[model samples]
Structure formats: C-alpha cells, structure tokens
Target: MKYDWILFDADETLFHFDAFRGMQVMFKRFGIDFTEKQYADYQLVNKPLWVDYQDGKISAEQLKVTRFQGWADKLNVTPKALNSAFLEAMADICTLLPGASELIEALTGQAKLGIITNGFTELQQIRLDRTGMSDYFEYVVISEEVGVAKPDGGIFAHAHQLMGNPCKSTVLMVGDNPHSDVLGGMNFGIDTCWLNTQAAQRPEGIAPSYEVSSLQQLQRILLA
Candidate 1:
C-alpha cells in the first residue's frame, strides 16, 4: 500500500448512519410516532447544534442532550434517556457500507487501520462489534472521548499520538465529510481521501489528496 496507515471516519464512510430511522425506532419505544416533518423539525435544532459542537462552541454532552430536549419534555423523559435510546437504536441498525469489508480486508495486512470519528462514543463500539469490525482497526478514536471534534487539529493530533506519531506522509484519512475529514486531515499535514458517494459539490477553500465514489475504488487506488 502507498500509505502505512489508513484512518477512517465512522458514520456513512464505513457504516450507514440513518439518524431518522434511529429516531423513529427510539420514539416508537416511548409510544410516539416520529414523522418526517418531526424529524425535519428535529434537524433544524439538531444540525446547528452539531455545527456548534464541531466549531467548539458546545460540548458533546450538551449537543446530545439539547437536541432531544423538546421531545424529552413532551415524553416526560430526561434528555439523556432519549439520547441513550437513540444511540441504542442507531447501534442496532448499523451496517457496513458496500465494499467496506472488502476494502478493510484488502488493507488489513498492507496498512495498519484505525478509525478517527467525530461520532459519539456510545454508538461507535457497539456498531463496530455488531459488524464484526472491532478487530480490524488498531485504534478507534472517538471525538467524544478525545474532547475535540475534527476540522480542529487536536482530535487528529490525539489520533496521531495513539498511532505513535507516524510520519505524516505515510498516513491517509478517509471520510465522507469534506470539511471535517478532508480538510481536517489536510490541515493536520496528512493525506486525505474524500469518499464522495453522495456526489456533493466540492466546497471552496478545501481540497482532498484523493477522491473516490466508493470504497471499492479506494481499494483500487491504495493497492494499485
């Protein structure tokens, strides 16, 4: 492999993160039917909280709790309870992306693998375990635990430290989010691969070292 280490983002890069489905499952348990419009309303509050979280304006706990506070009030439950149920729902629904297993299997011996995720700590491990991906990665770095999200260099710095400070040139960070994953890796002085399966427009002021539509393509590029 061209890179000695390959780091991945957790949600949507390697596994499906169907937050709407997760929320529906979670709310069903509380006896409320979660509608698309409700989900849209939730996202209006939830998405900006995530942006604030990524921008270092709010802590993970605050984001998690605040996003669910409206529903929590309606359901007469604590925000933490709603959050935990949602994470549990997400974990139950997690699955590897197409070619995710093949890419990991192909890269196993060629390059050390790890995950550097801005995803929550609770959902990550259980999902990894369920998908039988726990043993494939050397490190599963969680921003919730690291106290910093991506696009900030600190989380990547923490991951690099855990990676034993490998030469920057020998590492690659692969993820779906351009700002956090691609730009963060670039700013951190490592190569990055953007998994642009959604085919979104490339944002200005950001460039990735590599871009591929699928993990299968990434496998070809890395092992070429």
Candidate 2:
C-alpha cells in the first residue's frame, strides 16, 4: 500500500457530543432552569469563543471557565456557580455519532491511524475513552496539548511526525470542516477527504481530494 497513515478529526467528525444533553445537564447542576431555546442560545454564545480559542487567542482553562462565565454574566447569574455546574454537566454527557465505531473498525490494519483534533486534551480524551474510540488510534494529538491547533501547519506537521512521516500523497486526512481539516491537510501536502454530513456546499476555492457524505461512503472508497 502506498499510503501508510490516516488522520482523523474528533467531535462531529468522529463522535458527536450530545452537547444539548451536556448543556441541559450542566444547567441543571447550576440550578438554572432553561428551555431548548436557551440551550441553543448558550451554544451560539460559546461556539465562537471556542473557535477563537482554537485559533490561539485563548487558553483551554479560559475556554472551559469563561464560556460559562460569560454566558452567566450576560444572564445575571453567578459565573462561579455556573462554571462549576458546567464542568459537571460536560463531564456527564456522552454521545457518539452514527457509524463511528464501524468506520474505525473498517480502517483497522489497513493504515496507520491517528487523531488530530482542535480541542482540549482532557475533554477530548474523555470523549474518546467514553466512546470506546481510544484503542483504534496509536497517536492522538489534541491542539491544546500540542500548543498548536489545526489549520495551522505546525499541528499537522506534529501529527505527521507522530505517524512516522508517511508520503504526503498516500496519507489521507478526513475531517468535517473545510477550513481546518481540508485546508490544513492541503497545507501539509496530504490529500483531504471532506465529510460533509450536513450537505453543505464545498467552499468556493478550496477543494478536498475526496468528498463523502457519511462514514459508510468511506468503506466503498477504501474497498474500491
């Protein structure tokens, strides 16, 4: 086989955190009552902060603590209380995406596998262990632990090194995000396969070498 490595992205790419449950449980811990609309509001407020954190503008501790703090601050709640509750809730939730296990099983022994995710090391590891996806990966690099996030060439370079530096052409980077996963792989000279689960249009200029709507599509591509 010409290719020796297959790098994956966590979160929606590998496992989808039932973040709604996480949020609801977290809120309940704080003694705050909220409807689904409020949970959606919390995500809207926190998501951009996470993106900024991934881009190096913030720290993991800040991400964990401040997202809830800021939200509570806006809602006139005690930020400290919310933070503690949020942590507890985040710790409690567990939801893996559809086909996650089957996809990992399908790839086993076919190529060297690893994870390159732009998330906190502790939380991301928890997700993997919780979802039983940890053993499948020989290398798992979280951006916060690595001190560099994806879409930054350094993280990809670091993941490549972790994978023992396979040929760029042969290595395939599969991710759900166009900017981070697709462009990041392009920067590393690795072929990218975008997983567009939502049926979003591929961005205007950037292109992935392969595009698949579901994890099952990967099986056909690999087999063929």
Candidate 3:
C-alpha cells in the first residue's frame, strides 16, 4: 500500500446515508407519514445547515435541532428528541456501501484505517457495530466531538494527532465530498482520494490526489 494511514469519510463514502429513508422511518414511529414533498422541504433546510456545520458557522447541536425544529413543532416534541429518533432510525437502516467491506478487509494488515466524519456521534458508532465495521478502524474522529468539521484543517490535524502523526504523504483521506474530504486533506498537506460515484464535476480550484468511481476501483489502485 502507498499509504500508512487511510482515513475515510463515513456517510456515502463507506456507508449508505439515506437521510430521506431514515426520516421516513423515524416519522413513522410518531404516526406521521413522511412524504417526498416533506423530504424536499426538509433538504432545503437541512442542506444549508450541513454546509454551515462544515464551515464552522454552526454548532452540531444547532444544526441538528434547527433542521428538525419545524417537524418537532408539528409533532409536539423537542427538536433534540426528534434528532435522536432520526439518528436511531438511521442506525437501524445503515449499510456499508458496495465494496466497502472488501476494501477495508484488503487494507487491514497493509495500512491503518481511521474515520473522520462530519456525521453525528449518535449514529456512527452503532451503525459501525451493526455493520460489523467497528473493528477495522483505529480512530473515529467525529466533527461533533472535535468541534470542527471537514474542509477545515483543524479536524484533519486532530485526526493526524490520533494517528500518531503519520507522514503527510503517507496518509490518504478518502470521501465522497470533494469540498470537505478532498480540499480538507489537501489543505492539511496529505494525499486524498475523491470517491466520485455520481461522476459529478470537480469544483473549481479544488483537486484531489486521485479519483475513482467506486471503492472496488480504489481497492484495485491501492493494491495494484
């Protein structure tokens, strides 16, 4: 392997983060049918909140509570309660992305693995345990705990510290988000791989060390 430490982004990079499905499942428990229109409306609020969270403009708690506030009011529940329920629903439905298991297994002895995610702590651990992926990672750095999200070098620096300060060139950060995972790693002076599964155009002025359409392809590149 070319890298001694491999850091992965949790949502969509390794796990299937179907927020709409998770919300639907969560709302069902409260006797509410979450419709596509509602989901679309939710995204309008949720998406910007995530960007703010990533940019360090909002706290994780704020993002979580604010996004669910409308729904919480309608359901006559606290936003915190709704957020917890949503995370629970997400954990219940969490699954590894295609080829995630194979890739992680392949790199087990060759390199150390870690996860640096902007996702909430409430869901990450349980989801990893349920998917049998908890043992593979040596570190799981959550933005919620770190108080800094990806695209900021601070979170990556924290991850590097947890990794025992591996050589920058010998650590590779992989994720689906070009902005957060790719730019963050690059700015931190480490190698990065963008898992562009959707074949999205690269954002201007941000480039990754590598790009692949699938984890299988990334595995092949790493093991080549």
Candidate 4:
C-alpha cells in the first residue's frame, strides 16, 4: 500500500446515505407518508444546516434538533427524540456503496484504516457493524464528538492524533465531497483522493491528488 493510513468519510464514501428514504422510514411510525416533495422541503432545512455545521457556525446538536423541530412540533415529541428515531431509521436502511466492501478488504491489513465523518455519533458505528465493516477501521472519528467538522483543520488534527501522528505525506483522505474531504486534507497537509461518483464539476481552487468515479476504481489505483 502507498499509504500508511487511509482515512475515509462514512456517508457517500463507504456507505449509501439515502436521507429521503430514511425520512420515509422514520415518519412511517407516525403514520406520515413522507412524500418526495416533503423530502425536497426537508433538504432545504437540512442542507444549509450541514453547511453551517461544516463552517463551525452551528453545533451538531443544534443541527440535529433544529432540522427535526417542525416534525417534532407536529408529532408532539421532543426534537432530540425525533433525531434519535431518525438515526435509528437511517441505520435500519444503511448499506455500503458499490465495491466499498472490496476496497476495504483490499486496503485492510495493508494500511491502517480510519473513518472521519461529519455524520452523527448515533449512526456511525451501527452502520459499520451492520455492513460488517467495523473491524476494518482502527478509528472512527465523529464531528459531533470532535466539536469540529471537516474543512476545518481541528478535526483533521484530532484524527492525526488518533492515528499516532502519522506522517502526513503517507496518509490519504478519501471522500465524495471536494470541499470537506479534499480541501480539508489538503489544508491539513495530507494527500487526498476525491471520490467523484456523481461526476460533479470540481469547484474552483479545490484540487485533489487523485479522482475516481467509484470505489472499485479507487481500489485499483491505490493497489496498482
């Protein structure tokens, strides 16, 4: 392996995060149909919160509770309760991305693997365990626990500390988001690979060491 430590983002990098489907599953308990339009509306509330969370403008607790406040009001439940239930619903529907298993299998034992995700603490381990990917990662860092999100050097610093302060040049950070994953790693003085699965246009001033369309491709390049 080229890297001594390989770090990954959880959602969308290794796992498929279907928030709309998860919302439908969550609202089913309340007898809500949770239409597509409702999901679109929910994204209006959720997306900005994620930006704010990554920007250090909001706490993860605030983002979680605020996003569910409207639903909690309608259902006569606490926002925290709704958030927990939503996480459970998400866990119930979680699955690894295509070739995520193979990529991890190929990388494991060759390099120390770790996860650095902006996702909630409640859902991370459950998804790993459910997908049988728990043992492959030596560290699973959560933004909620770290009090900082990616694109911020603090979270990367925390991860490096957990990794026993490995040589930054020999560490590779891989994720789908160019901003959070690529930019963060670059700013933290580590190499990064952008998992451009959606084929989205790369944003200005954000460059990655490598780019690939899928985990299968990433595995091939890393193990080449």
lDDT of 1 at 167: 97
Residue 110 lDDT, candidate 3, scale 0-100: 99
Candidate 1 residue lDDT tens string, 1-224: 68999999999999999999998898888888899999999999999999999999999999989999988898898999989999999998888999999999989899999999889999988998999999999999999999999989999999999999999999999999999999999999999999999899999988899999999999999999
TM-scores of all candidate predictions against the true structure: 0.99, 0.87, 0.99, 0.99
The models' CA-based lDDT, in order, is: 0.94, 0.79, 0.95, 0.94
**Candidate 1 lDDT:** 0.94
Clashes in each model (backbone N, CA, C under 3 Å)?
0, 0, 0, 0
For residues 1-224, what per-residue lDDT tens digits would candidate 3 score against the true structure? 78999999999999999999999999999998999999999999999999999989999999989999998998899999999999999999999999999999999999999999999999999989999999999999999999999999999999999888877989999999999999999999999999999999999988899999999999999999
Ranking by lDDT: 3, 4, 1, 2
Model 1 CA lDDT for position 118: 85
C-alpha RMSD in Å of predicted model 2 compared with the true structure = 2.6
TM-score, cand. 3: 0.99
Model 4 stretches astray by more than 4 angstroms: none
Q: Report the C-alpha displacement of residue 60, candidate 1, in angstroms.
A: 0.4
**Candidate 4 local lDDT, 1-224, one digit each (tens):** 78999999999999999988998999998898999999898889999999999999999989989998998998999999999999999999999999999999998788999999999999999999999988889999999999999999999999999889988999999999999999999999999999999899999999999999999999999999
Q: How far is 62's C-alpha from truth in model 4 (Å)?
A: 0.6
